[model samples]
Target: MLTVQDHELVAAAIGEAETRTDGEISVVVAPESDSYADAVLHWALLVALLPLALFATFPDLLHWATAFVHEPWGDEAPPLRLIVLFLLFKTISAFLVAWAIFRLPRVRIAITPHETRTRRCRRRAIMVFQVGTERRTATRSGVLLYLSMAERHAEIVADELIQSKIGGEEWGEAMAALLAGIRAGQPGQGIADAVRLIGDVLATHFPYTGTDPNEMPDRLIQL
Candidate 1:
């Protein structure tokens, strides 16, 4: 979703933002937050069992199908073994078809529950914050801006010092600006705008001192 020029733009924005605040800022973008293989399996299994449920609820449907395969001159119903085998074949075929279709990234993401995507994206952003930005600054003023493209989700994680000083709602404007950029298909611009807003907030509470050192890389991290 980002090109070389976009990457450079985001990196430059972060650098510019940090120059005005003691807080450190980092941006991370991901193609997706999770593989969702389990979700795919669940959907495929449901599809495979649908026919069984239908036949169980309405046995007449099964009988109607069996009659088509039975000889018209024969008085006997279709063999039970044949019926079982046919059902097994159909169930397996349905499962394979569903599995194949859901394996695609776009299809899987489209069918995934909104709550699931939001939860996964949040979890990933937290993890990234913990590993890379949390407590890495001298004053615990590190911030991470994370974006998950497939889910169309964004998150901002602040270190202990920033969190103690800033309310979560204080970042609403920054979040809104970021999301607007994303919805407009300009992720780079969205991220840069968010960084600028975040920088203004940080500058208000933690204005840069001449002696403050650059504690983090300014480049945008892509995953």
Candidate 2:
């Protein structure tokens, strides 16, 4: 969610960064990497099983419920079919209620494991790099800087040539700077700072040659 001015600043940063290196750089920002609907369904299933678990743990509870359903004049307990239907109703209700609550964006994100979000964000970034940035440059030095707002995660995906020369740990400073800006509620600024740092790294390994062509767009992509 960047403003017009922020967009301009990021585009300028990309342009300035490219001036020093032949490497291609692309910036992509997304609201979220995944919907995580499967996680919500899993939680709902657990809630639905609670009734069955309680019934199994305390057989007397089921007996009491059956007795309550019987007629006052007749001392006989409810039929097996009636008891089964009641249990099914209770389980379904629990599942429906839990699903409604957990489907909320804030609640869903809070309950989701951080590791899951990170993994999904990384996977999405890699896919994006492959589709748009990978092997696009003459020297195959393209890099994709991706940020997921909902997960609060950032990823740096580089093409074959860049990855061969640069280790994952080498991007620590750029990642830290980008995350710090996000934590401070300035995603646009954070991305630009990361871009500059990345540019420095690329420039060191692949200096801009007069014959190098601009193979990628300089604008920031929002998704």
Q: Which residue runs of candidate 1 sit more than 4 Å off their true CA positions?
A: 70-78
Off by over 4 Å in 2: 66-77
lDDT of 1 by residue, 1-223 (tens): 8889888988999999998999999999999999999899999999999989988999999988777766563756447866897689889999999999998999999889999999999999999999999989888989999999988899999998899999999889899999999999898999999999999999999999967799899999999
lDDT, residue 184, model 2:
90
What value does the lDDT take at residue 8 in candidate 1? 90
Q: Show the colliding residue pairs in model 2.
A: none
Best by TM-score: 1
Every model's TM-score:
0.93, 0.92
| TM accuracy, model 2 | 0.92
What lDDT does model 1 reach?
A: 0.91
lDDT over C-alpha atoms for residue 99 of model 1: 99
Q: Could you list the CA RMSD of all candidates, in the order they appear?
A: 2.3, 2.1
